[model samples]
Target: MKKDYYEVLGVGRSATKDEIKKAYRKLAVQFHPDKNPDNKDAEEHFKEVNEAYEALSNDDKRRRYDQFGHAGVGSSAASGSGGQYGGASDFSDIFSAVNDMFGGGRSRAGGGAPFGFEEFFGGGGGARKGRASAGIQGTDLKIRLKLTLEEIAKGVDKTLKIKKQVACKECNGSGSKSGATESCKTCNGTGEVRQAQKTMFGQFVNIAACPTCGGEGRIIKDRCTSCYGEGIKLGEVTVKVTVPAGVQDGNYLTLRGQGNTGPRGGAAGDLIVVLEEIPHDLFSRNGDDVVYTLAVSFPDLVLGTKVDVPTLDGAVKLTIPPSTQPETMLRIPGYGIGHLRGSSRGDQYVKVNVYVPKDLSHQDKELLKELKKSQGISPDAHNDPHAKSFFEKARDIFS
Candidate 1:
């Protein structure tokens, strides 16, 4: 037997069109599939709510509903329509009306309007179809890729073993039991459902996906033994991705159609790989330039000298200008990372560290004593007003 349209919306036959609309809005929000997520009960309820609202919200249909009851009004039950519309009416109508009220782009958490969010923005019109482009896309998956400094500089290829969610071979995403499919009992095969409640705010109704059938508008009487009727399985697969040189950390690479398989054989979503770079112990990168530190003798700082320093290319001799200050920095151009798009390489910088011997030989002590006396300087010269100690001077030297 058909339930009364007013009863479907939990309203009296005398309810005003505004009352019908309000009731439908409440039910649609509560039962939306995105809200219910994977829960079968929520999905089914979601469908029922939409179906009921479809019948009672339109003036013509609502009038017909008042005159002939549920049978005379004809089944619409979705949030918008007259008797002229049916199961194939644009699925987004109810959603669009809700969107106008919500005042925001579609919510990532599934819009508050179960019907309004996904159904509204995902795409729709007043038609159902067999169009080639029509179908659900798979859910995208993410993986973090770690790159070494050298590998990033040179660019590298990596083969990864990743598991993606694919539709079950057993039921093909039908969530069915065996080969037997049945109409959704909760939604009555309309794929939508509605209900009303009295809250502090007022009397309201909610719509949601049909729980009994998970919004497919049909039920699986028997479960697929392999998938237990859920219709998706976890499988492992290997894929190789090429990491381009100069790939920045936190950047993502997308492999199209490499994500989870869509339900009902829809197009596959993309796989997103996030790149992360590992820090190097021997080298520090400053933009394209590399930085290195080499120790030198005090005499080298005063007299100046060429010292061998390690670079990405190899050990190169770095010349310090005469009377070069301790911790002076020198640039060796074209010794750093290569330009991502150009032929040029970045420059490398070398900082000189001047050190005093910890242990003095008899000859060294004599030489230093004579040298200090000749220069009118004492062993405590570092303690003078103008000088700082070796440890404290590193900052000044480097600075």
Candidate 2:
């Protein structure tokens, strides 16, 4: 059954372009096949969602779906089942746009992107033409690396030397040696086969792509040794990438044309770099704020002193008032990582944790006793319900 596009994205029918994109990106990440393996239903729903997004995300298709519903919007797909959507639409485009949802992320033309010629001119081999026989685009690549908090604080550009695949220079992307290929005879090299069947409803005729040549309309005899008939060779390539400041974990930067080369001189695909922020030993990032845990001695907190504290911008002296309680957080404005596109920087939050003396000598004990007696107080007076005596909690947690 056909489902409404808005329903698939969980958005209202009047959603704007930005809202639609947000919803699609969320669902794509959630129901992506990599995230939900071993579940056939989820995988199917994922594909459906991709298809819905692909159609509605486009202006023309969205208008068509809005005015004519699924029937008018998808009639090409229904009838194109006989063959392909010759020119009006490119099935291969649709397939590549949604292939990530399927376990087989490969495009119909293997690693290459679909060609426009297949959409413009219906090849003689196939009865109906869409993108079924379109040339393929290159493959997308993913690389993961760790980044330090300081590196993320300031944007950086890095040049990485890596290995991947490229089109076979020896064969010129033909997968054959010195023009050793010829038209396939299975379906007369048309790359498609036609058949007619009589049914009760009507004499239904079905037109399908040629299976023998794999819809390429040609056959290779002596394959190229460089790519082993795949028309792509493994090689090393260098790519320069810029890491924007304030980029969070799981954020991706796309470097186009850095992927494997396309067959027959097709354009190369893209390389996606996913950033992973490493936790700093002395600092943590909260949104745009830099946080550091500063330990203050009990005497320092009680006597009131100006102590040096570390911040992203460097060390600054912070004043601690007398009788200051533990767990007091102080903020330094405009000291953290600068907003990637904004004018101001994030603030740095210093969390003060007053440390109580754990090892007390005889003289220290006597001095504490005398001080408490002078104040007419006892150790029990320090008891706090928010996790018995903050000092004890800190000591227990740290030790």
Candidate 3:
């Protein structure tokens, strides 16, 4: 059974066109596919909303529906009036309603009214000729660059060899050995072709690049022998890149006009370098901070000792204070990674791990027994804070 159109939009039959449009806008926005993705109920409700609007929004349709119900509106309710109601019509109408709500102006290049969904979701196809051009832009390229912690701490320069399209040297990007050409007859030098297509919405004109001259608007009379009339060839080029300090993994550096050259004499694109961090053996990165674990003998921890600690710059002497805890962390300022585009440097954190002897010799055991007696050591000494345990403190490092 068909539900009442007035009930669907939650408006009276006496509602004006502006009221109908306003009600439909609210319901359409609430159930739009972009807002309620993967929801079947919202999709169906959205269809119902559009169908109700299509009928009530039109005076003739609304009069026929009011007088004789679905039968009076004709086969529109059954075949969905070729997208006048629901299903595929739902998707297109949803975008139409959205465009109206946002006050979007339709494209005037085509003779027929614009299908909002086709223009909104589907990227501009060959239909719109006003924005068409003869010169094609080159495609952008991406490359992965692996950097070490040291390189990230200190900005480094790298030379990259890339394979890209370069303008042919033989004809100087003209694609002709004799530099002779004639205007294309197929597109009439417009560099595009327009074709008319009939749809449910009416006649629509589609524009595409000219097939004969490949959108160049001219035909090559004499082909270049080196590039075979392509006007471009694959070649290797070296690019010098300066990676900034403290750049994290997955960050990108863009080099404009450094990618493949366009066909003929078109403009070149960009080359993007994505950064990847390589792990270090002794140090791990935490934001701008460097984390390193330093192992010291039990005697060194009790009596205090000076040891060399590894840093982003170099190894430096770090003092372990007397009676220091096994899990104690020491911070050295201005010894870690440098700030990107800034003058400040980060600090390095060193964690201490005390080492205990696993085996004891006879003389060592005799001295330990005398010391234990003098110190009044008990069997439960393992529970002491200074005693070695299997538990280890975990550190979270970004790298």
Candidate 4:
């Protein structure tokens, strides 16, 4: 039996559009083919999630599915077999949706392929037309960008050198030495050729890009010597990228039309910048906030003293109150990383630890022995009602 659309998406039947979209995004990311490479189970789950979202995202399809279950949304309504639910056509929509979720900018142009799936799915070679006729889109490029805590606290701009396919300068991307071409004999200027395939269900007609002209409908009579008639060459270019503040690891920013240029003046591809957070020497990140450990002398903790605390910006003075306990956390407002959205910044947490000397001089031992003779100086004699246990302090730090 087919799984329920709501069940496949892990949502209730009455889920709102926003709720459905949120669930779909979570599931899509979890089971994305890129994240779970070579995992057949995850790939199936991804397709299922896309199928469920497709049926639920649209109000009309959702209403029909709700009234008549699988029959209403299936290929032929009468068959109720769902043959077209997970077909090649749906993959395009699935990729487009994923791109919208992670693209972080403008939508792709009309004829552009999403995530360069054409190479994987044979350019949607099943009944889908017009795309083969249109100019082929260039493949997207992905690069990892490492940022430090300081850089993440305040956004930064970086220039990256990328090597990719650029349009040939000799023939101006036309692939012809004389800048002239003729219509393809195979596809006859249609850019696609049709073929018949026998399947278990029935005979199916498949449409694919023409092999002669590579879907361009035209062929170069005289090939360009520079690019060997491919209309592109591998070259290097510098791209300026502005990384936003508070971007966590695994997060990515998309630069539209900044990837490899399309072959023969087709649509350009996108540049995907994946952010990687470099480990900090003195601090660790917790969500938007940063945690830092401060080591102070025993006297500073007991007698109370102002000490310098390291922040992303610089060192700031932190006042320790009298009788401050060890493992106590202090907060410095607006000293941490900024929020990804909005103007607010997270507070930096300073965890206090008493610094103990590994080796002490005879004079230091004599002074310590003298202080131990005083009342309330010994651990057994020290009794504070407000003092927390070691475990309690550890829990408070995480909380």
TM-score, structure 4 vs. true: 0.63
Candidate 1 — which residues are off by over 4 angstroms? Answer: 1-101, 104-138, 167-190, 196-205, 218-222, 262-269, 338-344, 373-399
What's the true lDDT of residue 278 in model 4? Answer: 98
lDDT of each: 0.66, 0.70, 0.77, 0.78
The whole-model C-alpha lDDT of candidate 3 against the native structure comes to 0.77
Candidate 1's residue-wise lDDT over 1-399, tens digit each?
545556667888778878878987887677665566556676555556566676666677767766777666553443334322222222344444455654533342243443543343332221222334312456899999998877766678999999987777777665554556777788887554555544332333445555554455666667777766656677887888998766677978999988886654456779999999898777788877778777788777778887788877778988877777766778998887766677677788887788878998999999987888764333565566555565577787898
Clashing pairs in 4: none
Top candidate, metric lDDT: 4
lDDT of 3 by residue, 1-399 (tens): 877878989999799999999999999889876688778788778777888888778889889988988787777754574254445535555546655753453453233545543353333344324433334556788999999999999889999998998888998876789877789899887777765655554444556667787766778878999988877889999999999999999999999989887776666779999999999999988999999998898768878999999888888999999988888999999988989979788999999998767898999889877877854334454466554342222222322
- Candidate 3: residue pairs that collide: 126-207
Greater TM-score among 2 and 4 belongs to 4
TM-score of each: 0.54, 0.56, 0.64, 0.63
Q: How many clashing pairs in candidate 2? A: 13
Model 4: per-residue lDDT, tens digit, 101-218?
5442122222454443232324334222455423467789999999999999988999999998888899887667988888889989877787665544333344667888777787
Q: Which stretches of candidate 3 lie over 4 Å from their true place?
A: 1-134, 357-371, 374-399
Best by TM-score: 3
Residue 186 CA displacement from its true place in model 1, Å:
4.6
Model 1: lDDT to the true structure: 0.66
Ranking according to lDDT, highest score first:
4, 3, 2, 1
